[model samples]
Target chain A: MSHGVHDTAQARFAPGARVRVKPGRPERIAPMHLRTPHYVRGREGVVARALGRFPNPEDLAFGRPGEPRILYHVEFDQPPVWGEGEVGDTVLIEIFEHWLEEA
Target chain B: MAGTPLPESVELLDKLVAALKRRGVLVEEDIARCQTQAERAQPETGARMVARAWLDPEFRALMLRDGTAAAEAFGVAMAGAPPLGVLEDTDRLHHLVVCTLCSCYPRAVIGYPPHWYKSAAYRARAVREPRAVLAEFGTVLPAGVQVRVVDSTADYRWMVLPTRPAGTEGWSEEQLAAIVTRDCLVGVTLPVAENARIAA
Candidate 1:
């Protein structure tokens, strides 16, 4: 079994904890592959739940043994994500811990 | 015929394929076989899981607990696929799936995504304005019902366990499965029991 970071660390945020997606792209050695969507960048949301840790996809794309990152189901209200929408409607996204911070 | 070099992507693909074959790591037949398998596991494959979940309580619980095992119960192979997450739909909630960055779907459950799913327009508007997109698909949820747009990602895939339509009391699993269309599985539309009548 490929035991890695995902296996060792506890998730920083729990379900219902408010968090924010880190804004802007970080400089990196390898070309960035897809991870978080730009639409949700810098957006505020609550942790719907924590999911299993998997290899960081950004590193995986470059053929590296990417350390596992904690994945979370983050829920953003429609009003904040878009300029207009029903108040209660929300967009749920899967974000890794690295892309998130306590809001 | 050989006047111009092949398009860069095609040329690169040819070289890559040649190298893989030389290394005995891949073969042309494998690609064909994968395509065939993907085509076979279409919406119908998911319909079976949905219908069984609707008809059997224990099965529904099992499906919710472990989706991959649930697929295995139906003999659907899920090798090399991302974890399958089935979003449940109730009177108060509806789940819509999109890949804002790219088209990442539960191909094992729903087969290849439709052409429209990969369009840039869909990628942009789906998360921004899902209600309008749902309206375009002819599905209009009454006010107060929360619409949760599920953004499927590179490592995770999603599908909706659509709220089973009313007046389908005695329908067989096969008949129920028949109504679970691909669009409904995507949550763009709801399953319809067009022929079922509510018994008086």
Candidate 2:
């Protein structure tokens, strides 16, 4: 396992943490190669697992040495995302630490 | 008759491969070996692994603990492949896989991903409206069963070990393996005994 540029201690969130995706416009973040999806912005989910620290892909796309960021497997209730039509479903999205805030 | 022309993208890929070989970034023989390995590592390999896990408790534990190692033990070549994670589905919880960023899949184990798995609509709706997507795939779960959609967004590639369907008891490993389809491994559908009958 190749540890990227940072350590686990620098990680912002841990497993089981309740987090909300930070809402932002893609244009405001960068002009090209954004890793965080648009639909997930502003959605709330719990951290299912900590996927360890890795190079921030957003920076890596530009051939820069991306500073490592903690990634989490965030699980969201289906009803909240897609409404009552999907009451029994849950969706898990892998998100970086930068895009998350305490719920 | 003249052979059909290759797609522009494929032509470009061939050029890129030649360029890489010239630059010493890739070796032709190594690429050939990897291609052979990929061909051997088909969806049937994944199905076999699922069947073995269904039959042997120790293998199941090992599979859950370290998927890549378990795959290697079964002679599945995983060289230059992303790490594998096997999600076991129980009666209460189910699993689904998507690559929200791109079409990242466990190609080494399950071969090439289906076209739908690589579609933009799937990537968008799978997270936003998974139940609807699964419904379109003809996999309707009960109200009590919780669907867990896994995004293969990082270095880890995920596959589901769907719960063995009922009425498969006393069946041989090969018999059980017949029912485990690529969709079942991906969690889009469940393995039915009747499907096994048709396949057999």
Candidate 3:
């Protein structure tokens, strides 16, 4: 399925980078199945933070593969994104390392 | 006998919301909280963060690092009745939120979304091409700034707190909030002032 971010270079993820979940407390709940928003998956984003890991949402959402990966905060710019007429300069989103790659 | 035809969607949605509450997906207290905030809530944390970033390079970096935490530092509660997630607006990526299935939302933080937000036209078309969709809503953006679309599903909800508007060399938080219209918070419109279209 086409995920839909026009300028892939604007993302922070490396084309093929293996990142792990660095877990934490209530702040870092892991092994959870979650429906990672479509706009954020497989996009290149900088490793903004190493927020400790917990149950990943994918597992928690569907009740399968409960293994949690290190979560990283990723930020994206607006101009290159929506293709003209945006308010802010950048957008920030949280995602696991498994979702990143070199653009 | 009184004769009246109610908009089926409104009546149905109200009933569905009630049913969701009855089924424990949401509670009376949750509904009450959403109401109170919807009537009066504004994006204090987002505005303050943008303002501080405008003045401080470091805080902007922090905002980029952890939006929820950065918002919390400014005294905005990161957690809400329903979990809240931050969706930033970038140059290329525009953000719009919708819930076709239900009004799954981060009610505690940004407050209840407007009635139009959950509409089918918004939900379907927004995912197709958000910029065009926003334009239809009269939220014409400047030369730059891309639009990214966000879907509010049963599992997670989203909100877009537009960046601080221009003008007002120095405006108080309350004054700033005044200009931060409901449209701005939802990413449907931009908050403009000063040379930024003189919204006042």
Candidate 4:
């Protein structure tokens, strides 16, 4: 079976890569429909795993070709996210490559 | 007979369904069959997998490695569904599943998701304040144990394999499976031996 929407010759981020989520504008203010969570924007996390390549849902939702984007499982510290919790706790999100930058 | 009025979204969904029917995008018979399959789904499928994993180390390894294949080996059909990933809860770590974008779930294995799972509050709070969310569900983990909230996005779906509760040693697989509740699989609660009495 096909692994994902499109096959990429190489993955953008390898496992354990440190990356930061781009702090894009909120959906109400943004021009495009973004699938990344608002709360996670601007946050730093580690690439937990490479979840393969898939069509960018943000573009796909609008009936565009979507192209292929590398999806990574990123894990963030819970305390940094929630502001008062177990430090060991973490939140993991599947993010598209476009939403990430090397930290 | 009178009944509650359908929500605007429901009405919109009806229109969408009617449109799909007119366009032949969906057949009535197929919709009915799908509804039947959804209704027939049970948490027992996940329970069986968890029970087997608990009993056999090799099966547990397989489940951790490839969840979909392990599930199919046990006769759970996963056709047309996204890939399945099983998260194992250890002594130091716990895993919770949520879909912030929408209510994407492992319907093939766990059946229909609970209504609360699809709520905006859950989607928002799960990523922002998961500890509080879990506390609201009566799952207060110890301070030292780490909680990991996994977002189900794109082509992968996740389920939690909760750590086996105490006081159930030497129990049969059937007995163990009895205590494995849907909430446990969702990572919101732990299976208790007390509840197993009723489940048995």
Whose TM-score is greatest here? 1
Reproduced native contacts, each prediction: 0.76, 0.69, 0.00, 0.71
Identify the candidate with maximal lDDT.
1
lDDT of 4 by residue, B83-195 (tens): 78889998899999999888888777788888788888888788777888998999888657788999886677888999988898998889888999888897888877788
Residue B161 in model 3: shift from native, Å?
Answer: 5.5
The top-ranked prediction according to DockQ is: 1
lDDT of candidates 1 onward, in order: 0.83, 0.82, 0.54, 0.83
Off by over 4 Å in 4: A5-9, A26-31, B1-23
- Candidate 3, true inter-chain contacts retained: 0.00
- Over the stretch B1-200, how does candidate 2's per-residue lDDT look in tens digits? 12466799789999999999999998989989977866776788889999999999999998887788878987876666766778999989989899888998888679978888998898877777777888898999866888888877776788899999999999999998899999888888999899976876
User: Against the true structure, what is each candidate's TM-score?
Assistant: 0.88, 0.86, 0.53, 0.88
Cα-based lDDT at residue B17, candidate 4: 91
Q: Model 1, range A1-103, lDDT digits (tens) per residue?
A: 3532134357889888999899876545446786788878888999987777888888888898888788888999988776898888998888989999999
Span of ten consecutive residues with least summed lDDT in model 3 chain B: B148-157
**Minimal lDDT window, size 10, model 2 chain B:** B1-10
Query: Order of all candidates by TM-score, from best down to worst?
Result: 1, 4, 2, 3
For candidate 1, the lDDT comes to 0.83
Q: Which ten contiguous residues of candidate 2 chain A have the minimum total lDDT?
A: A1-10
lDDT of 2 by residue, A1-103 (tens): 3553224566677778889999878767557766666767899888877766777787788898887778777887767666564576777777888889999
User: Per-residue alpha-carbon lDDT of model 3 for B60-140, expressed as tens digits?
Assistant: 676655555556676655454333455656654556665544456555445555666666677655655566777787877
Residue A32 Cα positional deviation in candidate 2, in Å, after optimal superposition: 4.4
Candidate 4 is graded, for docking, as medium
